[model samples]
Target: MQPTKTNIFLYLVAILVNLLSFSIGVSITWITSVIPKVDGSTITDDNPFGRLLTASEISWIAGFLPLGAAIGPLAVGKISDKIGRKKSLLILGCVNILSLVITVFAKQTVLFYISRFLAGVVLGSSYSVIPVFMAEISENHNRGALGCSVGIFVAIGMNFALVAGPYLSISVYSLLCISPLLIFVPGFFILSPETPWYLAARNDEKRLTKSLLKLRNKTVEEIHLEMTSILEVVVENETAAKAGVRDLCTNNTLRKSLLICLVIICLQQCGGIAAVLIYMPKIFEAAKTNLAPEICAIIVGVFQVFGTIVSSVVVDRLGRRILLLVSSVFTCLTLVTLGLYFRLNLSDVVWLSWLPLFSLVVYIFTFNVGLGPVPWVVMSELFPSNFTSIAAALTSSTCFMNTFIVTVTFPYLSTFLGMANCFFLFTVVTICGAIFIYMVLPETKGKSLQEIQKLLGSCG
Candidate 1:
């Protein structure tokens, strides 16, 4: 079914917002060499600790922005249901621009850390809420595509940054990351037409008609009929006091949905994607590649972005479950191979650089296609409108904590275990996660939040 032109516009909006939000850090990965060591004055790897950092510390630092970004969905979500989504997005865009400014001048490690922490907050709000906002505006038929655009933009943002970062100085790169905030170019001046459900929830039928007409390009009568389609089965939420955090847990359906969201995000982290993404330099270094760590990292970012775009093409066409499962299987093999190749003697002959390089490339591809997109998609889809505000908030918070855990620990973990062994652990976790998804996660490819609730109710 063809979506209204408005839906497509919203999809583009989602893509731009996500791309702008994620690309800043992705691009920064290339500039880490320029990030300065020994409290931001020295360029050498030498530090008082004598170990400056392992690949894991590098990986951990790579993840810090996401650690902050973890809050994006929840804090913004708490307010999005009350205020308009567009406005919430506007706040994030403005903040993104400012954060980039802070990053550009940051010299001290403390200053850079503060900049990243704030950037995390910017992403924390924009990326999480944007996808949910898109899902709300779309029907079940286009929900996956709309939602999947989150990943697509994420990939594009990373790609754009990767290409931009290596060639550009660190100062120019910071500004570039925030430039995608121009989403408000058309967004702010446009109608800001309401979602059909949002209009219905407000019980302002007259405004609902106006919003739907603008979206559907339908007549008054047709808009009314379409509004009824969503309103007929929709359950309007209670007062704010009722939607509190504790209340979300009390709802059995919401509880299960929360668990689903929680596990998927944890899986995303445990899979060590952030570690891989931010530390692409270290991954190549471990593999003994001839390329400079900075340049090799950029290549990984490029491939990661391409893989995400390819996933967008196949995502809805293939269905979420199968894609996720395939990602799990291939990811396991790739990680294991990379691990073993580095551990075992593989430098015996020329042309053997293919083994580790090929494994890392395929591993990146598998991750982009499956685990990378699925976490955001599933988290965005699993909640109903009634519970969306609090549920999304909780989900984002959980994601943030996991982000912190992985970011902080991954450095130490990678050092203790070889990057090879580190990946082997991730592989085992991902395999187990595949089993959990198969057994516990339900297919949400073509279902609205209402229909999904019914399915979950039935499962109960």
Candidate 2:
């Protein structure tokens, strides 16, 4: 067998990184479904909070983790820049354990909110740190797959949480979802190693050597040569300051990257992804169905896994821009159709008993194809290393805000605008998303991060 750049140890570490992301996915996804158990259901509109409150409160609960997770990529990116990705991951592991301890015992909405908020912080961190870890460890040919593995694992974590969460009763059973932490905590600790890029960033040769030995134990010469190439790339791309908001804004290239980040993320949430993912049951009711919404939830979650798997497989081969464009076109059609279907109240036709379910399934498939995996892939590819994490944070923050607005607004929107209008509104927004992506979004596949930055840089 040909020797591989990724050693068993680094592969294991990458797996740990994926596991952390997955656990976060499960923790975040599962608990979100449980929030209404305390907060109340939107369909009935009779929570401890008012119906509007049920919307507002659930929005707060649902948005917190992503909001909190938004902070992570920036924090871990910086920490990884300074300490190392492995150490950063380990610290997050500790934070995960601590946050869960608090969440598991949380009594009130406030405490629960804090737990979700803090957990989001950790989630964001994992997103930032793990890719850097993977990119640093793998050879160029393998990096894309390795980077994408994070998505697969993320789906795995989310799906596991989805299947398990609804099956178990809420409250304590909900709390038990934290168990991924136990598996991840020890698994990341003993099994995961520090990212070599991190070691090189800090100029920790000894530790870098150790990381090299762990990932590629074949020869010190091979390790040294590999480290040199990576460092040269890093040095060649080195900039004057860290990836501050100012630098991101003032520089035309960085600004475009930021815009891409913002637009794509906005596109992602505006697709009404949260409605289906967060409230599968509510969406089914919109479809006027007798089917189990929970089953649909699991189904949607599974689509994410499979869609991401497909994207990971074909992203390099088919190219990023085409996939995005195709994804957007399909989504536009689905959203409009879904909107009109509800608008026409076509759910009750004898032959179309499963219309809502079908719409949802198709929507899920299209979403997973277009918005689910593409945004993150784009974000990671857009920024240079220095700006990568904080850029991720900024991107994540904007995305989550859009997400927050949509989630908080959906219930009220459906009531005020009417359900048909709501879906139609989503359709309109998605159509616009397709246009913006075509016009403004840059193609990044098959280019190094630095090359992308150069291509995006202003000529004048």
Give the alpha carbon lDDT tens digit for every residue of 366-396 in model 2: 6766577767777777776667766776776
TM-score of each: 0.87, 0.88
- lDDT string for model 1 (341-415, tens) is 767756444577767666767887888887887777777776666566566666666766676676667668877
What candidate 1 gets wrong by more than 4 Å, as runs, is 1-63, 71-74, 183-191, 236-241, 345-349
- lDDT (CA) per prediction: 0.66, 0.70
> Considering only N, C-alpha and C atoms within 3 Å, which residue pairs clash in candidate 1?
56-411, 72-124, 72-125, 74-393
How many clashes in each structure?
A: 4, 7
> Mind sharing the TM-score for model 2?
0.88
Q: Cα-based RMSD of the predictions, in order?
A: 3.9, 3.5
